[model samples]
Each structure stands twice: as C-alpha cells, then as structure tokens.
Target: MAEQASPEAKYQLGTPENKQFLDEQRESLMAFGHRFPSPGGSSYWLGDDGTPWTDRNRETWITCRMTHVYSLGVLVGHPGAAELVDAGLKGLRGELHDDANGGWYPAVTPTGDYTPDKQAYAHAFVLLAASSATLIGRPGAQELLDDAEEIFLKYFWDAHEGLSVDTWNTEFTELDPYRGLNANMHSVEAFLAVADVTGDEGWRDRAGRIIAHVTKWASENEWRIPEHFTSDWKPALEFNRDKPDDQFKPYGATPGHGIEWARLITQYALSAKIDEAEKQRLVDIAEHLFARAVADGWNADGAPGIVYTTDWEGKPVVHDRMHWTLAEAINTSSTLARVTGKDVYLNWYSTFLQYLDANVIDHKNGSWFHQLDCENKLMTTVWPGKSDLYHATQSMMIPLRDPSLSISVATKEG
Candidate 1:
C-alpha cells in the first residue's frame, strides 16, 4: 500500500513548482493558436509537426474549443491571444453559422460549405465557448450565447426525457433516433459554464437533471455507463461493438468520460450549493465513478497507463492510452482531494502525475502526446497531432481553483 502524506504536504497541486510547470505548459499551448484561424473556421487538425493541416476541413467543435482556450489566454494576459479569440468569433458569426438552418454546422469545407449534420456534441462546445467569451466581455459573445441557448432549448432539449437529443438534420427537420450520453455529458459541462457566466439557475438545474439521470444509469449498470441509446432512452449497449476503437462512439464504456463526468458532477454539486444530503449523494456518485474508472482503466492491460475504453466486465477494450484519460484522472483526483480532504485521492494524484510525466508529456515536441499504444509508445490511430488544448490545459488549472468555479471563471478570478 502507498504511504499517505499529510494534507498540507500532499496538496502539491497548488505548489509553486506545479504552478511554474503549468505556466510553461500554457505558453507552449498558446503557441499553437497562431496557426488555427482560417477562412472557414479554426482548422480541424494540426499536424504533430506544429503546422495546421489546411487540407483537413474546419470543424465547429475545434473552433469552439480554440475560442474557449484563447478566451482563457486573454484572461491570463497572454500576448496575441485576443487575435485568436477574435478569429473564432468571426468564424462563429460568419461561415460556421447557419443562417437558414438556425444552428451551427458540425463541419465546413475549406471553401465554406456547411456539412449536412448538426450535432449536440459540437453545439455544446459552442455554448461553452460563448459562455467563456461573454464572461470576458467579448463583442458579439452575448448574442452568440443567446442564440446557442435558444437553439439548445428549441431543438436539442427533450424535457420529457430530461436529456438532450443526439443529432438533427441541417434544417432541424429530422431527428436521429440515437441518443447518446456523450453529448449530454458535454451538455452538463456547458450548462455549468453558462450558469457561472449568466447567473442562470435554470442552467444549473438542467445540469443537475442530466447528472441525476446519468448517475442513476451508472449505478444500475455497475458504474460502466452506457454511451449509446435509442429515441426513448433505451440503452444500446452493442451500438459500436464492431468498431471498438471508434473515436467518438466507441464500443464500450469510456473510462475517460466516466472520470470526466465525475469531475463535472462534483463541480456542479459545489457550485449549485445543494442541501447537504444532495451534495453528499453527488459526491458519493463521483467517487464511485472515479474509483471504477481508475481501477478498470489504469494499467489493466499489462501496461502502466489508462486505457481508452473498457468492456462491461471492466476489461480493457481499446488498449490504446489516450492523453485525455490521464488528464481527467489527474483533474478528478485533485478535485476529490480538495472536496473530501482524502489522502487516498492525493496519493492517486501523485501516482497519476508520475504516469503523465513518464508517458504522456512530450517535453521534446511541445504539447503532450495525444495517444499511445498499449506499451506506452506514441501512436496516432484515432487522434493525429495535438488537436486540443482544452483537456490538458484544464488539468493543470483545475487544481488552483475553488472547485466551484468553472475553469474559465476560476482563471478569471484567480
């Protein structure tokens, strides 16, 4: 068993050494923002060689993530950060926006034609991006937030089901029967940000509803929350069994998402200031989710890292280790420590940091490696290049916050 350190010594997340390391990491991440802006939107992919892949189409999800990240950059006073944020605003206002369809497109070609699908996964990020930008008082951000909220309420939200639907046609005429926890998971995250920025209790209530729904499902399913579902919210447990490594809709439970949900639910519970009983219930669910993810994900595959997905029985399905998984594990462990004052969470935090230091951070290349094989060597089957800064950046920043504030709000007030 790992020896426990005193809380004063174990809370190394706020130490100056970690702060300096995070600052350096932020600097490296901001360097990539300069290459993201294009005519269509933020480019969907960046080559590992640190160049934007112009051949790849622009995507709303990537654009929104960049917007949210650069808004943080602006909050932190990074040089040239405002330019990227403005570029993202321009894209949201111009090409990505569907003047006829009413919601943003999932992707647009470089020449500016919108993709056919409008997805909740991407739109949730739009809500998040707009929320962060509005908090920073960016021009047009309020309008964007208003529009995103309207679209969400009008099209995606299924109040009867207490969850958001997965996708719709470009004109919002056809709804896909497929429901997904992934989109709702992100919706909870976006709702929290909206609540923080707008002081909207409604958004927080919606987040709590989603959290309650998912937590119930997770508890009934042995903590391996199902990702896919039908129109009436029936679990589609075998939705992607043939494609076990699909990037978005993988076959089995995503441990990273389990951990991510754990962190978000804890944040929601704290920020909403629920009654002690409700708060404790949320915390208990979060602890169970995190514990299950760590046990099934970390090193279950004869390697010293978290696997991307796991079967219902807690066996590794996709043995590849994703950088985002460890990032969320680090974040949830840190938050659990801060919330519960538990030494075990602190010990897990230290262990995750060691794993990240040895396997994930690409000290030679700048940002962390996005994916690795079972043996922990760099591999790029699912994700090519450092396409996102949101997860890793928050992993470094979450430890320094009050746990109630979303990362954007926390950074602004820090």
Candidate 2:
C-alpha cells in the first residue's frame, strides 16, 4: 500500500501550494457571481447541483453578502466582478430598499412586495456590504453606507444596552422582544469594516462597547455564549429548547458563534490600537473563548467534526455539523496562530484544513456543502443548498492578510 501521509504532510498554511489553493478557491467563489445577481437582488438559494433557484424571494442579507464578496473580487482584479458589485448596489438602492420606511426589507418577493419585518441581522450585513463597496470605490456606495448607519443608529441601536435590537417593523413602529447575540456579533464586524473604510474611530469604539458587553456575558457563562436573549438584554437560556436547530434562532450555546466571536474580538483589539494592558485583556479573553469552543465543540459527540450547539453544561445538544462552524474554526485558529505565534493553533489549523478538504469541499459542486450530519454525510436539515459564499470565501481569504485590517482593505493593500 502507498505510505499514508502524516497530518503535517497534508496541508500547511503560508506555504506556496496553500497560497495557490486559496487563489483557486477564491476564483471558484467569484464564479458564483454569474448565478447570483438579479435585477432586484441576489437569488436567495442555489441548488446543491449548481443551479440558481430564483423562484424564492431575494433576501437583503444575501444581497449584502454577495455585494461584499464581489467587492472583494473587484479589489483583487477579478474580471466581471465590478458589474456584479454594481448590480448588488442597485439592489440595495432599488428593490430591497424601503423608500417609505427608510430601511431595507428583510426579504422581497419577485413581484417587489417585501416582508414587513426589518431585522438588525440583515441591516448589519447591509452596512458591511456598503462599507466594502465604498472601499472598492463603487458609485453610490458611500450614500448607502450613510443611510444604513443613520437607520441603524436611530432605530436599532440601544445606547443603554450597548447592543442592537433583534428586529423591528418596516416602519420602525414596534420592536421584537427577542434579543440575540448573533446580530450584535455581526454588528461588531460591520462596524469594524465601516471604521476601516471611513477612517473613523467612532465606529471602532462602538464595536468595543458591544464587545465588552458580550464578552462579559461570555465570561459569566463560562465562554459558552448564550444565543437568545430578552428584550431587556437578559439571557433566555431556555429559549427554543424544543427546537435546538431552528436555523437562525437555535437554542442553547452556539459553538460557531463563540469561535466567530474569538476571531472578531482579536481583530478588534488589533485594529483599535488600545494600550498594552487593554489589548492583553482582550487577547486573554479571546484565547479563553477559542479554547472553550474547541473543547466543547470539536468531535464531542463521538464524531470527527464539530457539533452545532451544546448545552450550558458543555454537553452536545445538536449533533449535526455545520459547514460555517468549521469555517469559523479555521478562521479563529488562523487568527490565534498569527496573534500568539503558537504552534498549537497552527496544528489545529492544519487538522481542520484536512477535515475541510476531505469532507466539506464539494469538488463536484461549485461551493462547499452547507451542512453535514454527525457521520459527515451531506444533509440539509439546517441549511438548504449553498445559500451564499460569505463564510467559506472569507475563511479562505482571512488567513492571507493581516488580522488588524478588514479583509477587503487588507486584500486591497496587498
């Protein structure tokens, strides 16, 4: 038999071969532009077989993610990327925008009627997309960014709580009592990107406040950050206990959110330029968060992959694996390796890369598998066809640049 390769022999970050692979992966993701862009917004879903499913309504989050991805493509000199970015911009300004309500809709049907709900999660992505497009020097991007910020601050932001609310009516008439950490996490990400693009310190400071609040919650909860919350910013640990894998609002601690928060908090520390003491505090917290997530998540349920959600006591709650969780694991490991210069993180990085290579990457399809069961077989229990390229594309690109700068700016400078 041929000699079985050791783990180190499989793949390593920063190697020339790995760099070339990342480039090819990026190219493959950029090819998705051909199927995503519609006159209204990007299509909400793409079949696992690589067919565009445009019958579903267009989503604001999908449009924003595609715009952000194509903006990165434009920055990297990919052909035809600017057109896709422009199409996304048009979506933001036209069909997706609620001209009467002064905010973007969560979803818009093919006939142009939009869902009445306005969500902070979708709005945060709008900010992120606009910021990236602004960095790429796209026309009307600055205006979009300005409008997104104004609406977010005026309606969604709660200065007393230091976090964005979960949802609102289209006219901002009423707010949902259900709060969430997911939106706040993405808000931090969007704020950082806006800070980078605008050269403004306020946005970064706002992100810091949000991080401080969430990190406190994470610390108090032993780093298994709670997902659902009351409108008053209290953790509702039992929320959705019956439906543990309800896609967006899952119950219990989400391991993927912890990993993502680790990466984002590290980036915040680097970009904010805090004093040594404060920086070290943030770094220590990030390390704790990442370690806890890895311990509770990776292969905890007699399987060789991370579980989706776990209970407060560190037992697996949802055994199914999610591709985005693995992607976040790769990203957090990469960031920690770079920040701490630790070989252990690099080793973890290599291991996860092996998992991704063997299981997640759908060579037959154009994108990675969205969900896999505990046995590592492809499934769609939580996510349908490859919805969007945001997570996977960012995972591939994040390791190539400095963790301090936003990925778009880092790619542009590089």
Candidate 3:
C-alpha cells in the first residue's frame, strides 16, 4: 500500500498546495522535455539527467507527444514553447511523415531508414498533436490536422465497425491481422481533442462508439479491458503470455489502461451531447472501471505502487510499477472525485501523489522514472529511457482542468 500522507504533506485534491505541486511538476516537465527535439524535428528519447539518447530512433508518437506538450506550454505562456512546437511540426511534416506513403512512419531509424509499418497508435498521436497545435494557431497545423485525419480515416479507422484497425504495410495495402485496444484508446483521446478543436460533433460521436465497445468489454471482464484482439476484434487473452512484458503488447489485463479508460470515459460522458441521465449512466460505468483497476492493481503484491498487468482472475502478472500507470491513477482518481463528489476517490488521488513523490519522481533527474520494480526500485527493463512528457504532463494538468474539456483546450481557455 502507498504510505500514509505525512502530517505536513500537502497534496490534497483542490487545495492550493495541491495546485502548487501540480504547477511545479508541470513546469519541471516542460523544462525536462525542452531537449526532446532532434535535428530532424522528431523527438529524441531522453536519458537520465535530461540528455537526449540519440542512439534510439526518433519516433512519430514521441514527437507528436512533445508537440502536444509544447503546444500546451505555449497556451500556458511558457518561454520558448512555440519553437519546440514548431520543431515537432517540422518533424511531423518531414522525416517522421512518409511523403511517399499516405500516413506517418512509426519511426525514423538511426541509420536514416524509416520503419516498415504504419501504425494506428502513432497516427492517433499525430491527430492529437495536430489538434492541439491547431488550437494554438501554430503554422501549418491545420494542414497537418487535415492530412492526419484523412490518412487515419482512410487507412486505420473502420466506420463500419466503429473501431480503428491496428497496422498496415507502408503502402497501406496490407493490413495486419493483429488488432489492439491501446491504439483505439488513444484514438478516443485524439477524437475528443479533434472534436473539441474543430467543433465537429461527429468526432465526439465516434469517440462514443469506441467507448461503448470498451465499457461493454470491461464490464463483462470484471472491469479489466482486453488489450489484445484478433483481426475480427475477438479478445486474444493469451496472445502474448510467453512474452508477458512485451512493453507495447503485454499479456493479460493492463490495469493502467482501465484507469486511463475511466478518465477518458468520464471526459466523454461529460462532453457528449447527451441527456443527464445518459451521462450519469456513463459516469457510473467509469466509476466501476476506476474501482476495479485500483482494487486489482494497487498493492496487489503488498507493494507501494500499482502493478503493470493482471490475469483474468485479477492476479498480478507483471509486478513492475510503470510511471504512466501511476500518472493515470492520479488523473482518474481526481477526475472520479470531481465527477462523483466522492471523498474516497480524492483520497486515492492524494495517495497516488504521495506515491509519485516517494517512488516515481526523480529528484536527481527531472522527469519521473519510467519504470520501477515491485519493490519500488528503479528499473528500465521495459522502458529504457524517459519517453515524452505527454502522460506525466497531462497527469498534472488534467486535475486542474474541467473534466469535460480536452487538456489543450482547457489550458487555452484558462
């Protein structure tokens, strides 16, 4: 279990101290991610102490996240934020994008070769970053948004099934048989952002369709949404059991995803053009998801942090504590507290913040440690270097914004 909040500790939700903590963290993250831009505008993975790990490939998803983060920085009036956003835009428009092909490349290899497959996961982040950039009136952002939306609709999104497909060959001709919920989850996020930025209610309805499928699956599976799926969208429960910690495609249920889905579903419910009764029903489902993920993931191994994955029976399969999981926990707990007016969720928020300070946040380094063992010791077996600031930055910002609005839009309005 997370240690009890110290008597003088000040992370209680809605308090000035909590706000200040989040503000400080947000600023620190902005500073840490300042070094993300590469020569080609794609993001460089940051090593400990905020140095770019150039040995790694520059990825479209990371670049999009940095673009989205710096766009938020611009809205918040952070110095030099626009330049970083421009750099990310340049990458998205140039190296990270496939001018020969339709959509963005998954990554630019170190040897200057692009990766083979074009993935929905990376494209979703492109849509999100473009939406956020467009909100801030960044140069060429609208063009990027139009391109991303068109490519995604053409290659990834299946209007008939109401769910996005997973991956395709570079030519967009051959689709991979493996479907996934991770990409779709982020699609829901991007859809919400695009809908808000463009004032197109159709995107919101699309997000609703995805959410309906997820909530139904989560409810039937004891609140643990199936991550892996077949081409036909059947749950592939045992897909990666031999490689239980495959980073992106981990086996078993991902409790962090449940926590994240809860937040997104809450945002969708609040933002959807639906009646109060329908919104309340959606919120109820979100609450169930939040409760079950916390019950299954948090302290499942008698530890101080949430575990990475759990079995169908709710047993921990991967005991590592991922930084993003805790971030989502903090975000969802605060969100559920606000939407439901429940102190229990607020207490969980405080607990997660305390856990972040004690276990995840690296005082010596800038950003949070990306991964830690079950014993709360820093480990990078899954995530080697610190990724982009998207998850952690949003974790700080979301608690301070209206649950119904996207973070970039909310930050802009404020």
lDDT of each: 0.86, 0.87, 0.92
Best by lDDT: 3
Superposed Cα deviation of residue 341, candidate 1 (Å): 0.5
Clash-forming residue pairs, model 1: none
Compute each candidate's TM-score over C-alphas: 0.96, 0.97, 0.98
* Off by more than 4 A, model 2: 1-10
Model 3 root-mean-square deviation: 1.3
Task: Please give, for residues 1-414, the per-residue lDDT of candidate 1 as tens digits.
Answer: 123444333335667776676677777777755688886455557777567887777888988998998899998898888878888988887788999879998888866666898899999999999999998888899999999999999998888777999999998999999999999999999999999999998999889888889999999998889999988888999898999999899998999999999999999989886898999999999999998988888878777888999889998989999988888988898899999998778788877777777778887776789999999998989988888778887787787777888889999889
Better of 1 and 2 by lDDT: 2
Q: List the residue pairs that clash in candidate 3.
A: none
The C-alpha RMSD in Å for every predicted model, in order, reads 2.0, 2.5, 1.3
Model 3 local distance difference test score: 0.92
Candidate 1, lDDT over the whole model? 0.86
- Candidate 2 residue pairs in clash (backbone atoms < 3 Å): none
Q: Per-residue CA lDDT of candidate 3, range 250-337, in tens? A: 9999989999999999999999989999999999999888888888999999888999999999999999999999999999998998
Clashes of each: 0, 0, 0
Cα lDDT tens digits for candidate 2, 1-414: 011235654357778877777778878877854578776655556778657777778889989998999899988888998988898899999989989989998888877677888999999999999999999889999999999999999988888878889899878899889999889999999999999989988889889999999889999999999888887888999999999999899989988999999999999999886898898899889989988988998889777788999999989999888989988988888898999998778788888888888899888877899899989998987888888888998888898888988898888889
